[model samples]
Target: MMDAHKLDCEAAESDCRFIVQSEDEGEAIKLARTHMHEVHGREVGDDELREEYLQVV
Candidate 1:
């Protein structure tokens, strides 16, 4: 089994310290995108999440 995929909001250079981890990368990205939009007012996309925030752990 592989480790869960991880994403940290701090990676996007935001002051918000949001972090998400899941076996499903899609889920992580979804949660991150939602958090960014609701809290930070940014509509982040999958490519940007994969490139800027996604981390393999």
Candidate 2:
């Protein structure tokens, strides 16, 4: 069976910290990362100019 508590924690982390909202954190992380790259010109999500996107969901 799936672990409810684990999923809840992961969901919250993947959503709040990263400003990412999705039914799938894996996909969401990739999306957020990609957006970070295109919009910020930083593939590693480390744009100090926009440090807000410097995190993976």
Candidate 3:
């Protein structure tokens, strides 16, 4: 997990900022909105976020 976090930390600032959060739900929800609109074409809800955050972390 530390290694993964390190890898993320090494990323270019723009890329890191694009994917990171401060445990901030409001920002995450906005990201989900963008993903749903431009990528998945499905609604993104809290349940999906909980599961994804678990896996990524």
Candidate 4:
């Protein structure tokens, strides 16, 4: 079975409550980054996203 990875925006910032989960960490981060850019109008880097947003589950 694939291990699940998660990204919870609420964990990083209380005002933004976005959550994304996927079997692959790369996929989760891609979705989270897109969400941040499209929805929040913030372009976040991959390194920063992985460091701040990604959580292995």
Q: For each candidate, what TM-score against the reference?
A: 0.88, 0.41, 0.37, 0.83
**What local lDDT score does residue 49 receive in model 1, on the 0 to 100 scale?**
88
Residue lDDT tens for model 3, 1-57: 231211121232233333534355555556655655564455656565544441233
Enumerate residue pairs that collide in model 4.
none
Question: With candidate 2 superimposed using the best TM-score fit, by how many Å does residue 53's alpha carbon deviate from the native?
Answer: 6.9
- Comparing 1 and 4 on TM-score, the stronger one: 1
Clashes of 4: 0
By summed lDDT, which 10 consecutive residues of candidate 1 come out lowest?
9-18
lDDT agreement with native, every candidate: 0.87, 0.42, 0.43, 0.87
Ranking, lDDT, top scorer first = 4, 1, 3, 2
Q: Give the per-residue lDDT digits (tens) of candidate 2, residues 21-44.
A: 455545555666665566556465
Off by over 4 Å in 3: 1-23, 54-57
lDDT of 1 by residue, 1-57 (tens): 977989888877557688899999889989988988998888989999898779989
Instruction: Say which candidate scores most in TM-score.
Output: 1
Q: What's the CA RMSD for each of the models?
A: 1.2, 9.2, 7.9, 1.3
Give the range where candidate 4 is weakest over 10 consecutive residues by summed lDDT. 9-18
Assess candidate 3 and give its TM-score to the true structure: 0.37
Ranking by TM-score: 1, 4, 2, 3
